[model samples]
Target: MLTIIYEDEQYVAINKPNGLLVHRTRIAEEKKEFALQLLRDQLGYRVYPVHRLDRGTSGVLLFAKNSAAATPMVQAFEERQVTKTYYAIVRGYTAESETIDNPIRPDKDHQHKEAQDAVTHYTRLATIELPIAVGRYSTARYSLVKIVPETGRMHQIRKHFAHIRHYIIGDKRHGDWRHNKMFLEELDSKALLLHAYEMQFTHPFTGELTHIAAELPENMRRLCLSFDWVNAVTKHEKLTDSPV
Candidate 1:
């Protein structure tokens, strides 16, 4: 069942699991289940998706109860008025803080489309060096990062991180195969490590500020526990500090 993290008269949010498509699309036509269908069935009502999350990314996803309610919410996202926070476990130890400003294609298949400007700010929260070896490195190094995107673009976080060569662990599309293989074979982790984490926006109808957070998914939490970064994860989950 989908976990409902926030709900009100006109809006609802779910902690979307990794690999769940936001809705039906031709690219994934063979997939029988989708978050939209499942959420609608669970609620027994129509819901409109205001934005989308990548099929491989898991975390806070918002929807409006009615079309009228969806309009403003959608506009908020388009206008970049909403704040989104994401957490990722990346392959190498990143800088204490960094910002990535680059252009990326809208999607992998749309090479003809013009690349859009994308900016991502991240702060390294914790680092770990596993004794296990992957590739030529004697020890595997990784970092937990808090990411905030200044613009919403397709695969922005994944692509931005890849642009800087700190590929997010478990990102099959743009990650290092050696690290991904290590994560799957050695750690038994298959889900993408990038998580939406939290979102804050103004209530479209009520004119109030709304902040919603989703707890880390089991796979991510387990990995954090193994890395001994659970305390850092817990501290950030509270949304205490402003987005970097």
Candidate 2:
């Protein structure tokens, strides 16, 4: 059964596992299981997705129980009223906290015409230098960062981090192949190290503020443990002054 973290008369939140699709997709036609199908069958009722997470990502995923709850909740996401926190394992240790305010556009011939503003805040949580031989030296370094994207865009965090030369580990589509291959061949893991850990927003049904979180998956925890960084990282959050 799917892990239902929070539920109400109007909504349900799930700790979606990595590799599950939110709904049926032609892109993933080969896969028979999906989040929508599984959850709906579990509840024997309809559920609406309020937001999306990449297929490779695992964490808190929200769903509205009925159509009534879906509209306003999705609108809230579109308007940037939600605060999301993500934890990602990336290549290399970042020296300090940084905010990336670069704008991105669609990957089309007219990419310039469809540009959108993108902003992301990132804080380094922990760093580890593993003595694993890959390419250059007898050691490789990795960093964990807590990321907050102010603007929602397709692959914003992944693209932005890659643009700055700090690729998220295991991001095969936009990562350093050498490092990714090293992880797969040496570490026996192939999933991207990104998790949508937490989210905060107003309850569309109750009008009260709400916060939801997902525990770090076992694989991610294991990765952290390998580096002895499981306890070194600290999590911090603040509410925006704007009221619900």
Which candidate wins on lDDT? 1
Predictions in order: lDDT: 0.91, 0.85
- Per-model clash counts, in order, read 0, 0
- Prediction 1 TM-score vs. true: 0.95
Return the top candidate by TM-score: 1
lDDT tens digits, residue span 115-136, model 2: 7899999999889887897677
What would the C-alpha RMSD of candidate 2 be, to one decimal place? 5.9
Position 40, candidate 2: lDDT: 96
- Which segments of model 1 are wrong by more than 4 Å? 236-244
